[model samples]
Structures are given as C-alpha cells and as structure tokens.
Target: MPHDQTTGIPPLKHALTRLLLILAIIAALPAAAESAGKPEAAPDIDIRTAQREFRLSSLRGNVIYLDFWASWCTPCRESFPWMNRMEQKYSARGFKIIAINLDEDRSRAEVFLKKYPARFTIGFDAAGKSAEIFDVRGMPSSYLIDRQGKLITRHIGFRQKDTAGLESAIRSALNRQESK
Candidate 1:
C-alpha cells in the first residue's frame, strides 16, 4: 500500500476516509431537505391520565388533533363538545384527538371533564411540560397533524362559529395523501 508522504497515512486508508466523509454527507442530505422546507413533525406527547398513559407516537398513521387546554379556559369548555363530536365522526376514518389538560390541579381538571365529558383521549400534564413542548401560547390551542405525523395547522382558540371551518380542515387532512 502506498503511503502519503505528507502525513504518513496509507493511500488506501486516506481514500477510505474520504469515502466515509462523502457517505456521511450523502446520508445527511435527506434530513437537511426535510428540515429546509418540509412540514415539521409534531412533537411527541408522553402524558399520564387516570385510565392509562398516552403517547402521541402510538397514534401514528392517523390524523391527530392535539389540543392543549386548561380548566379555567372558557373556550376550552366550548371546544370539548365539538372535539367529542369530531372524535366520534372521524375515528373510523383514521383520525384521533388527544386533548392534554395543562391544569396544575388534577381535581380541577376532573371537575372540568365531568362537565365537558370528553369522548376523545385525555392526557393530564399537571406540570405543563407538554404545553411547553407544544409551545402553547393560549388556553385552547389546537394543532392538526396529518397522517404522516406532520403538523398541518394550528388553531389558537375555539368559537362556535369556527366549527365549520375547523371541521373542514379536519376533512381536508383526512383526504390528503402523504407528500412524496
């Protein structure tokens, strides 16, 4: 094997080193492309509830409505019934709603849930860590994630009149195909 006079490294070893560097750069291209303009992946949610622990990744391949709420938020109260209806209407079509409560007091959330009655999955984040992960800026923020785990849209608040528009977004997501 010929040695490189400059650093005493073997020519074959130097060639292999350059090849590895090229391979590493090629391996990073896809990740760079994904980060450049592609839709961002929804942040994972690992939260606990009274019934069981919930993970956002478990519902991959389903369009997800990830909502962050608190007990004192009046708009959250209004959104629960609509979310329940959406869950019922879309579950069979590969849609799931995971609403995470940001209330520090679990009892407050329990009382609120008793009144609102969520049919969708409920996650309790008493420490508000999930809210921070989602960058929740308001009480009733919601994110619509496509089936491929990309975030499609975010709604900051809920209103009765927004029902049709929100449902339309969900339907569009349900109908959308994964980007090639």
Candidate 2:
C-alpha cells in the first residue's frame, strides 16, 4: 500500500498522532497557567504566650496588620517606630497589629524589642511556622487583613522609608470597617 503524500504516513495513524499531541499540549497548558497566579493558603499559628491560637481565621471582625520581621532585618528595624505609632493610633478603633518575629532566640528578640518598644502584641515564630503560613518571602513583609479577617493585601518589601503609607493602610482598613 502507498502512504499519503501529505503526511508521509498512513492517514489514520497521522490523524491519531496529531490528535494525541494536541490533547497533550492542551493538558499541559492549564498546569503552567495555574502556577502563574496561585493563591496561597494561610498557615496555622499558635500564640502560646497569649493563651490563644493565632490562626488567620481568628483575626476576623478586626482590621489587622500582620508584620513578619526578625531581629536582624534592617527594614524591620527602620519600620518599628512607625509600627509603634500605628498600634497606638488604631488600637482603640478595632485595629490590631501583630508582629510575628522570625527569630530563633527569644533573648535576642527581647533585647531588640527594648531598643524599639512596640505597643502592639508581639508573637514569636521561633521555628518560622508563621512565616511559612503567611508565605513570607522576605523580611518586613506585611499583610493587611480586613475586619472580616480576610487578607486584603500582601506587601512584600518595605519601600515607604516612613510610616506614612503604613498609617494610610491602617486608616483605610479602619474606614472600610466603618463603611460596612
């Protein structure tokens, strides 16, 4: 038997091969696209000192700014004063700022805290469990949570160089709560 000139192979075989290749390509496309903008799931955290579990779910009904920092992070050090001011300004307005420290040594963190005292609650994530939960890729990463306890925004790095924008975010969250 002579093969088809167009495909240089049997017609049925060529068609089947082409069909399979197309299906394969189509199947692989979704996986690639899915990875591009995957939504991260929040991790579980325990606030032992506070005698409360610090899961993301518990933050609902309060506007929260969760800052992930360490004793060694320069930006974190710079941002501390601003964070302190934010805590003082928003605490009575149903806004809570939680600073999750990614430090291994509590003593080091405590010493650092003395230099930059914070009015807000501070939690230690010695094993980096909270960082893993929050999908923190860098120091000074912040997550703004609405009153409903849902994550509204994720800030990867600190560029404000001051707390002006950070205060704005807190105010925005407070405003959003008031509107609703």
Candidate 3:
C-alpha cells in the first residue's frame, strides 16, 4: 500500500490531469500544422477579369503577388492600395499582382471594388477553386510566387502593420528574378 500511491496523488486526479494534458496537446496540433509549404506551382487559376481572361499559368515568368480577398474582409480593402502601389513600383521589374476576389456574389465584389479599387489584374473566383488549392484558412490570405511558379511564401492574414514585411518579401522575390 505504501508504494501504491507514494506520490500522494489519488488515481482519479492523476487520470484527469493526464487527460487534460492530452486534450491540450490535441488542441495545439492544428495551430502547429498551419504552414502550407512551397508548392511547385500555384493552383491553375483561369478566371474572368474585367478586361479579359486571367490565368496564373500564363504569368509563369514573373514574380506573382497573389492575394485571396473577399468583399466583406476589411483587411482586403486595406491591402488594395498597398498592393496597387506594389504593382506600380515593381511591374517594370517583372512583378504582377493578381488579386483573386472570392465574394460568393460577383455583385458584392463589384460593389467592393467601387470602394477599394485595385490597379492590378483583379480576377474572380466565385467558386473558390484557387482558395481551395491554397488551403486558405483566413480572409485576405496571400502568397508570394517566384518566376518559375513556385509558391515562395504563404501569409494567412493581413494587417496594416504587415505591409512592410510583405513588401520586403516581394522585393526579395523580384530581385531573384533578375538573377535568372
């Protein structure tokens, strides 16, 4: 009996503690696995743009600043001007910003655009095919893609504070294009 409970803890307490620990560990798993690593190619996006057909595969030779946006997403609105500036600043250096609108209704996207216009290629993904391929878990998700179509960086959410970091990554990706 002395060795049976030498630690001074009861069996029920020990079991509950172990169970809670396991549950806590289980809760941490999804957070730990959130990263979508570099993919060989971004999802094949063939969507309608205001001007013409927009295809991700067609832009294979340029650094692509791909962003998933929704009309209701406030951060998506904030991202537009920053992305527009980026497009103007870097387009001459072979960079392209492709903002994929994911509003369920095209009219919502149109309305949103009337408020926050993007200067780059704005495409429609009403069916969410590209967002599915990218495993998007949040609004305004974005990815930096290299000239060879490799997904270089995946960002889940956007903040106004995130602009500089995002721009730096884009600059790094654009610079890589010069060497190749």
Candidate 4:
C-alpha cells in the first residue's frame, strides 16, 4: 500500500511543529505590539516663560517631573514638600523637577516659591500657555516626562501616598534612558 504524504509525518511530529510555530508567533507579538505603540521621545516642547514670550525647553538628559500648579490650590501646596524631597533625592541622578506656576501673576508664584523654597528648576507660566499645552484641567496636575522628553505618565490629583509610586516611575524612566 502507498503511504499518503500528509500522513507520512507522525501525528506527534505535526502537533509539535504546530505548537512550536504558535509559540514562535506568540513570542513575536509582544515585540511587534511594543514597536507599534512606543511613543517617540519629544524633548523639543518649549516651555513659555513667565513673561509669556520666552520659550525654554525642559532639560534634555533628565527625568522631568513637570508639575502644573497654582498658589491658591491646597493640594498643590500640600504636594510641594514631597516634590521637593524627590528633587533633593534624585536631582543628582539626572532627575529634575519643574514647577510651572499657572497663576496669572508671577508675584504669586514668587511668593509661593519663597515659602516653599524648592531647589529644583522653576518656570513661570503666567499666560497659562503651559496649562493649555499640557491640557491641565485642575491644579496640582503633574506629568512625568522621561529623559528623552516623552511623557511617561500624568496625574490629575495629588495624594501623599503616591509619592513613592511617582518616584519609582521617575527612576524607571531614568533606567530606560540609561539602557538606551
């Protein structure tokens, strides 16, 4: 009797080959998905200064915790200390914090800074351009921007317990930059 070519291969061998192919395809999916969804680092977004004329880009080689806040916001005020601490701890490791004040009056920002005494870089968004660009809907909103200038995460509200999570996120961003 002549053997059928399809049946010549053992059933176990056919099943094993199919399983291997499925596994290989599954392994490739994650890489393809990541490549498709990965965000391009945008380090070129210039921040408008307090005078509402000068545009300045945030630091390029650092993880930037860009906090959009107003002096009158209680939650913004409360988050200041935690932000300051994170700045103090990570500034040396290429981590930077930029407090962009949303107040129309630069004096309000100056006063708030005086009271809080943040060591990180401060910028004034007197014309509210930063808020509009970042789409800030409320005070105390923050965006964690990676070293390559891609926005990694955004938080709309401030909570004391979130400090660790934010710090870890910054660290992860830094690590990703370093690896690349």
Go through the candidates in order and give the clash count of each. 0, 0, 0, 0
What clash pairs does model 2 have?
none
Candidate 1 on 140-160: residue-level lDDT in tens? 999999887888888999999
Score every model by TM-score: 0.76, 0.70, 0.76, 0.72
* Pairwise TM-score winner, candidates 3 and 4: 3
lDDT for position 128 in model 2: 88
RMSD of each predicted structure: 9.5, 6.1, 6.0, 7.8
Over 1-180, each residue of candidate 2 has an lDDT whose tens digit, in order, gives 567897689888888999999999999999988865453433446653334555656766788888888889888887788778777877888888888888898888888899988788888878987788677999889988777665667887776654576677778879978987
| lDDT score, candidate 3 | 0.85
Error of 2 at 120 (Å): 0.6
Runs of candidate 3 with Cα error greater than 4 angstroms are 1-39
Off by over 4 Å in 2: 1-44, 50-54
The candidate, 2 or 3, that scores higher on lDDT is 3
Superposed model 1: Cα runs more than 4 Å off: 1-37, 178-180
Put down candidate 3 lDDT per residue, 1-180, tens digits, no spaces: 222267676777777888999999999888666644434567776867877996688888899988899999988878888889999999999999888899889999999989988789888988998889889989999989998888888898779888889999998888877976
Residue 162, model 4: lDDT of 83
Candidate 4's C-alpha runs over 4 A off are 1-36, 40-44, 48-58
